[model samples]
Target: MEIKIDDLTGKEIIELIGEHLQGMSLNSPPESIHALDLDNLKKTEITFWSVWEEGQLAGCGALKELNKKHGELKSMRTSSNHLRKGVARKLLHHIIEEAKQRGYLTISLETGSMEAFMPARKLYESFEFRYCKPFADYQEDPNSVFMEKELSHFYME
Candidate 1:
């Protein structure tokens, strides 16, 4: 699999993002949904990537700069065809490495608290992320599950 910075203009990328949004809406109530759309993902503070295998889009993820010492995971979705194939894991690992490279001392994310989100929660846990109070402008919402992972040796880097 090849993972690289995405231009966000490719047809496959657009389709995949649409599918992701549709899935999120189906799994979580609209009022509790916080997934970013294409316009938001294109912001300068966010760096997005798409993974492709043999010329077909496999998955995508993004890192949003929250502040000098923090970053947020956004728009993480593995194509249905690639689910359970390590595509999400690869994208997640890539985002964490990039966060470290960018000098972020912590990485945080907000995912759904519903049954549909179990896999995502499990994935975050595997990377040592712990449940936390909402960070940034997020308010307390039962539908949201916040998690964070602190970067060790951040100052040394």
Candidate 2:
């Protein structure tokens, strides 16, 4: 798989992001959904990436700069066809490496609290991302679980 900085202009990427939003809508309440739409991902503060394999769009994720030393992971979604194929894991490690390369002291994310999100929670835990209170503009919500990983001493595999 080849991961590259996405310009968000292609039809495949647009559809992938649309599918991500649609999935979030189906799984989470309206007020609880935080998946970034195309407009949001297009913002300068966010660096979006797309994972492609053999010319097929495998997945996508983004890193949003919260501050000079902090980042918020966003838009982490693997195509349904790519599920359980290590796409998310590879993309996650890529994001972590990008954070460390960018000098981010910490990286954080917010995910669903439902059973459907258990796998995601486990993935973060495996990366040593600890549970934390909401950060940045997020407020506490029963529907959400916040996680943060300090990159100051994070070891990349």
Q: Which predicted model would earn the best TM-score?
A: 1
Best by lDDT: 2
Q: lDDT tens string, model 1, 57-137?
A: 999999999998999999999998888989999999999998988888999999999999999999999999999999998
TM-score of every candidate: 0.96, 0.96
User: In candidate 2, where is summed lDDT lowest over 10 consecutive residues?
Assistant: 147-156
Local accuracy of candidate 2 as per-residue lDDT tens digits, 46-156: 999999988999999999999999999999999988899899999999999999999999999999999989999999999999999999999999999999999866566
> All models: lDDT?
0.93, 0.95
Clashes (N, CA, C under 3 Å) per candidate: 0, 0
The lDDT, on a scale of 0 to 1, for candidate 2 is 0.95
- Give the poorly placed runs of model 1, Cα more than 4 Å off: 154-157
